[model samples]
Target: MSSTSSDIAITGANGFVGKNLRNFLHKKKINVLGISRKNFRKHASEVKITSTNLLEPKLQTKLKNYDALVHLIGTGRRSPKSMFEEINLNLTKNVIKACKNAGIKKIIFISGLGVSRSNKSDYFISKYKAEQEIINSGLDYTIFRASYIIGKTDYLTKTLSKQMKKGVIIIPG
Candidate 1:
């Protein structure tokens, strides 16, 4: 891909970091293909990604012709139906497969900080597994293990703001 062809496919484009990244990339005149479970009715972007779920096998066909894929899809909030391994690790496997099928050799992944050998948390393990899959996938990749990203309406910030409204700001001794 040429330097001038900055067409990027961003999954989880509706997320806070994804939204901010899209805006930043757009300012640099990079064309972005926003892919998310949710619809962006008022979005500035024009490309419509038909596939919403990565698990679907047909997703690969729709993902073709992009310079690179920025995979931001993750679920920090887990439920009985959605386990860490299933959501994080499994989804990553599917993404890698889709990337290969679409002929996209490059991928940028958003992982988490503290995904270390010592950590035993399910979250860290899942992230580590996801990273390992990407490494073993034979794709040229950039992985970002971010601990936290603060935006005006970031998930953490918004959650804290809601707690503050309920007057639960705690000061641990």
Candidate 2:
């Protein structure tokens, strides 16, 4: 099926990066469909939200009509190692498989910078594993390994700003 009219499907559309993307795409007059856990009431006119658990069995059937997918689902902070595997590894695998099954031609996956298989952190390991899945999927893909994105209300920036306000900052060795 041709994906001429279908909108771009953005996962994690309620997130900081997703919000920025949504605004930019809206300004460009591009249609955006958001797959988010919560309702997007503010941008409801320009974006449509679909509440979905990424691991659900019905996900492929639900996402069959989309033109392309922008996968932004991931965890940044430390958590149980299994959480990383679930969200970063398994969830990504499911999405890629679903897109392939649905005949979706393109995927733009948001990944973290400085991730490697040799890294000690479980976070980086999970990201690397996820990227591997995408690479081996045999689908048209763009993997954006991004650094810290600057936004006015970004959590990282806010935390950094707060720390800088204090006298001396200690760097981890």
Candidate 3:
């Protein structure tokens, strides 16, 4: 990092990883702006958080002049209202558009581990497509295929806790 901090914007800033990253960056004296679908709880005054629906066209305007965008918005589960394509693939497209429009030259995306063209799983397919979209966008990008990121309040911990309450846990051999 240079003596002057670069402005960095993080999407999904309310998530476990996002929150940790924001705090880490802040400690390093970097300027971090959080973009989330929900309002963030009260925190340090130096960090700014904004709420926005990524699917809408307003994201580009909101992203204006950021040096880089950390796109952490993604999902492995499916709901009746939202699917893998909608969140993983579509939202990535939206992010790319926003980044380009805002003149951001770099994107840091957290994709899923084992997401490849050969994987037939819907989650993998969607993630694969999202990675492709970023690669094709011609913007500088760093994508991490993270497997299980465990933390005190991480998704894996919550899911395992629920399974434990069920009295039976399923693990592949």
How many clashing residue pairs appear in each of the predictions shown? 0, 0, 0
Q: Provide the RMSD of all predictions against the true structure, rounded to 1 decimal.
A: 2.7, 2.7, 3.0
- Tens digits of lDDT, candidate 3, 65-148: 478999999887654334888988898998898888788899999999998999988888889999999999999999999998
Q: CA lDDT of each candidate?
A: 0.80, 0.80, 0.82
Which of the numbered candidates is closest to the native, going by highest lDDT? 3
Model 1 lowest lDDT segment of ten: 41-50
Query: Model 1 over residues 1-173: C-alpha lDDT tens digits?
Result: 34666688888788888888888887877777777778763247536554556756556666776778999988777444348888778888988888888888899999998897677778888889899999999999999999888879997788889889999975535
Q: Each prediction's TM-score against the native?
A: 0.87, 0.84, 0.85
Q: Of 1 and 3, which scores higher on lDDT?
A: 3
Better of 2 and 3 by lDDT: 3
User: For model 2, what is the C-alpha lDDT against the true structure?
Assistant: 0.80
Off by over 4 Å in 2: 1-6, 42-47, 55-62, 164-173
Which regions of candidate 3 fall more than 4 Å away from where they truly are?
1-3, 45-49, 55-62, 79-82, 162-167, 170-173
The weakest ten consecutive residues by lDDT in model 2 span 41-50
lDDT of 1 at 146: 91
**Which stretches of model 1 miss by more than 4 angstroms?**
1-3, 42-45, 50-52, 55-58, 78-82, 170-173
* Residue 53 lDDT, candidate 2, scale 0-100: 65
